[model samples]
Target: MGTKESDGVDPRVLRTRRDVVDAATELFVTEGWSVVTHAEVARRAGYSKATVYAHWPTRLDLMRASIGKICDEADHPEPTGDLRADLVRGLVDFAEDLAGGHLDRVLGGLLERSGSDPVVDELRRRLYEAGTRSLEGVLRSHLPEVDVEPSLALLVGGVLTRGAFQGRPATEEFVADLVDRVLASTGRGEEG
Candidate 1:
């Protein structure tokens, strides 16, 4: 059975939505949230403005779709069942994303415009959940229930601060040291 026919939706409609959302995500990530107008997304996706508007009625709609796409496409390292190793790998990948400038732009855009709109706040929450899913899982598995969130914050915040704020690379040594420090502080310490 043809899935589109089965679902009673046209394949063309699906393609248009996918194209438009991809374009919107690309624009939002590369140029920040301010540039993700319907007109721009329409232009980038090679769709008519009216077509874009027909699908997403407002700028926030476009932004919400774009943010959803970003979260859907987030890539994180696979966990190896080793808490420290998993965290290091995840943080290293995150650092690379930050260093590549895409994640930072997305985060900066969301943070800059956050708190003014509930939708934007939800988008920020979604992004955070998607971004931290892996590390959060590792932390939950290895740490006390009460310490999970704070430890997650400390680890991710350290990486974000080092890479984004301090403009320094989250090198392996730095990340390993960070993991050791957090683990020690949490009383998990390093495993032999």
Candidate 2:
């Protein structure tokens, strides 16, 4: 098994580490972030408490690991040639993932922690990156010659503001309209 210090760790150890992280992810999502402890994760993962600590020494470490797993597991839709449809689809998926119960609460908890913990801030940044990557990809593909910053900002910021900040529903129709407006401003509307 992979120890805390070894690279040539056994496969079993790697599996155990993965199991531990998976358990942490479930705990963080289902329960509040406060409920995640090494002991609880160890019990959920069926690993020893020592193993959990060996892999993630601090609660912050465990949170980071769990958040990383969540980000890694995010679904990104592939950009078809139809930019509008792709943008709408991606935005809707993004909103749903963010607005869904477990993820929404997890994000809220992270934001609450971010003010005091740099590690939590970094985790939030990583989550934001993961969330916007698909939109960026679509913008880059469709507006290859144009600077994608404005459009990317509109898509991400608009969606987040409406869905998370304003607590409005990001329905498919809303996403479609948002995409249309953004693309229209960029001169890449229905014609493009």
Candidate 1 residues lying further than 4 Å off, grouped into runs, are 1-6
The RMSD of every model to the true structure, in order and in angstroms, is: 2.8, 3.2
After superposing all C-alphas onto the true structure, candidate 2 shows an RMSD in angstroms of 3.2
- Score every model by TM-score: 0.93, 0.85
For residues 1-192, what per-residue lDDT tens digits would candidate 1 score against the true structure?
124432867779989988998999999989988999989999999999999999999999998888877787788767788888898899998999888848999999889988999988999999999999989988887774555888888889999999999988999899999999988988888572
Query: What TM-score does prediction 2 earn?
Result: 0.85
Candidate 1 global lDDT: 0.87
| Model 1 lDDT-worst window of ten | 1-10
Per-residue lDDT of 1-192 in model 2, one digit per residue for the tens?
223444788889778878998999899998879999999999999989998998899999999988888887878876777888888888888788768746677887798887797778999989878877988888898789999988888987787788888988988898888888989999888653
